[model samples]
Target: MSDAPAPTAETGTVAPPPRPHAVVAVLAFSGVVVSLMQTLVIPIVPELPRLLDAPASDAAWAVTATLLAAAVATPVMGRLGDMYGKRRMLLVSVVLLVAGSVTAALSDTLGPMLVGRVLQGLASGVIPLGISIMRDELPAERLGSATALMGASLGVGGALGLPAAALIADHLDWHALFWISAALGVVAGALVVALVPESRVRTGGRFDLVGGAGMTVGLVCLLLGISKGADWGWSSGTTLGLFAVAAAVLLVWGQWELRIPEPLVDLRSTARRQVLVTNLASIAVGFAMFAMSLVLPQMLQMPAGTGYGLGQSMLTAGLVMAPSGLVMMAVAPLSATVSRTKGPRTTLMIGALIVAAGYGLNIALMSEVWHFVLVSCVIGAGIGFTYGSMPALIMGAVPPSETAAANSFNTLMRSIGTSTASAVAGVVLAQMTTPFGSVVLPSENGFRTVLVLGAGAALLAFAVAAFIPRQRDAGSDRDPEGTVRAASGEGVAEPAAPVTRQG
Candidate 1:
């Protein structure tokens, strides 16, 4: 086969085909659905204890189950998309979303609901595919803008889904929330079929069944251990065994991958200082984001008798989070401009700093509903900027053929971060609840502790982003074979030098 065409940036020497705005919209909408699935159930999580006859602690697993599945599936799907056509895999993911939602809507038992969440998690690959699609379909002039919108879709879908979920769950039954998601999934599926074009760049390789299965088992064990630990007892044999199994499986899998051709994940490139550091930062942001999502709703929905709560209904709490989505949407184009003006590294730094500031503000000003809303905008801006720069960094660091897989790996890191955060946050809340309490809810002290943890995570993310070495957009530094060279003090690869001689 002839060489695959290079992605046409406005400044790229070669230009790819021009994609219509409708196609871009379709790609972005798919991303929106993936993001919506991540947070749409938050309004109902606190109420799950009452609605499903489960403990509040047990109900939290519903969210973590979804996170685990998504984290494991994302990189696999990206690798599959790289081998097969992205359009084919993306369509399959949408089908999973529809089926998952319908199943969840019809189920009365938590068992089937957990099953549905795992299936829905399959859709997490859509965002990475959308980013990959931009490189294939959009001209150079549009790629940056299109990628920026795809990044923002994450925060936008999350922000918008809350109010809609709140409205439906409040007026109708909680099952209605899943039913609505099912309907939206059907619509999104149809739109994808109608508007999205098939990818021209497809690689030939067998699916790495062994690698995929190993990673899946390891991920499931790790996530299950973390998600259920508080309920299962941290020191219990079951949890301890799961942790040991996960560690062993993942370690063996990593070694296996290094020896295999067409590995499920290109761990060598992914482990590069640049890619590894960026992924670490992505995880921290994901952790902080989920921490905020969990804390805010509980605070907003608790009865007015609680000195720390505003006593708002679920619908009101959802509404408070809704504006953050709109603000995130508004910030995307701005992020694009920032990337062009100051480069992705600088843009990411600004975003990380904004997140730290937002968390700091939350520490000082979370008493009133409006205060929470105001702080959310700041957080949304941070998300928009940070999300946009991740792809730009990944795209510029790896070869063109590795784009989707690299992006998906980044997404997977974020999911892992979120899962870890959910687990840790649960532990913090579980430990910090006041003994003198009545029904015994997480007191103001629990929330303060969570916020402090979130702020510290954001600061760690900032440190990671701060240290990522600056590189140009051409990506020539990494070369087609994925080599790195050390320079004077910084680990700068010599872009202009011959690839063979540099390393």
Candidate 2:
């Protein structure tokens, strides 16, 4: 019950006790578990209408609901983490996942299923929260690779879970998928409770209820329109109205954030050159990454008679994509080393170039399964590098107090990019289709065009990364709390002012 010892001027910040590895492992596991939810229902999406006795369009909400909920919850949860506690909020997120999984498992209708998916989506903050926790608790030496692996978990779980989910959906009752997720969520939550310690870095303040509400409304409107715009008809009044509302709400929200004493997101900090450029680059990288996901699967499964198609089954396609996840895991340490030596900016540029190369390669080699594997692995490795460096860049630029919120904002940028990619790819494929008997399918040229666009996005990210200002050694320029230290003529270090907190 007694308070722990505080750091002294001589000892500096005391490192946490010797369980860093365990902490990293548990956190990375939690990230993977959370990401698994993204693809858990993909195997069953096509059958949802029949199974739930709903229209296909209505059944599609099962996916759209999760996307909208995650977009709204990620930054909100992150801000809450900064105010209250990251670990506490993380546990709450996992609990939502568990509850959602159980609900979905028990449901026989679309209503309950949609509810459960939304709850699961609320858990998407786990990755950014985990990254923020690493920034606070891990040794400076251990932080880079730990965060890289944590970021890579997003791709790792999605790629790996597809095959697993397909296997489950094919062999067992579809309900078993949610049941498995529930078990995994329970394990992840318990591990976090036992292994992760709450940090001393709380940004104590009254919750910004107004800012939070504005952000939620704006993001919900914006993302809802983006995710469903194709279905609603891009030029339809419903879609256009939502877009206009989002723009107005976000403009007001931005003005409000700038004026507020305690805002949900610290706009001035985010406006810093380093943070701004990195976030911009993240969006492009995210767009590039998702385009591959959109194109490769279709190319792999289109009947072999299509000339370019590999004619693989859903399960086979998932298996082929699985190696990319493994490759990403393998690259994390190497990515960390590159960031350590050459700086994260260089690492990011290298990653962007690699991704562009991957897409370029895919354009030339779409005829064989091995070619898809090669391209995916290349892109995954690049993603591993880019994802790894993003947290380092964001953390280096922001105060420790705002770590979770800033990181969550970066994650949101990536999601926005992916959502945009989905929309763009959907439109391209829908517009350019080949007729086969009574049905139509996306043409090979349409898939090629998507891959070409993916390459262009990666190049764009590389161009943006080139503008980020260079920095000193990764951890040397910033203090334990991420406040940049200034050098004085007398050789004493001066700390940047702490971020303001209002009750």
Which candidate leads in lDDT? 2
lDDT of 2 by residue, 131-224 (tens): 9888777766777889889999999998899899999999999999999999999999999989898865677777889998999899989988
Stretches of candidate 2 exceeding 4 Å from the true structure: 1-13, 477-493
Q: What would the TM-score be for candidate 2 when compared with the true structure? A: 0.95
TM-score of 1: 0.89
Supply candidate 2's per-residue lDDT for 28: 93
Pairs clashing within candidate 2: none
All candidates: TM-score: 0.89, 0.95
Least accurate 10 contiguous residues by lDDT in model 1: 483-492
How many residue pairs clash per model?
3, 0
lDDT tens digits by residue: candidate 1, 433-463: 7543447778788888888888888888888
What lDDT does each candidate get? 0.77, 0.86
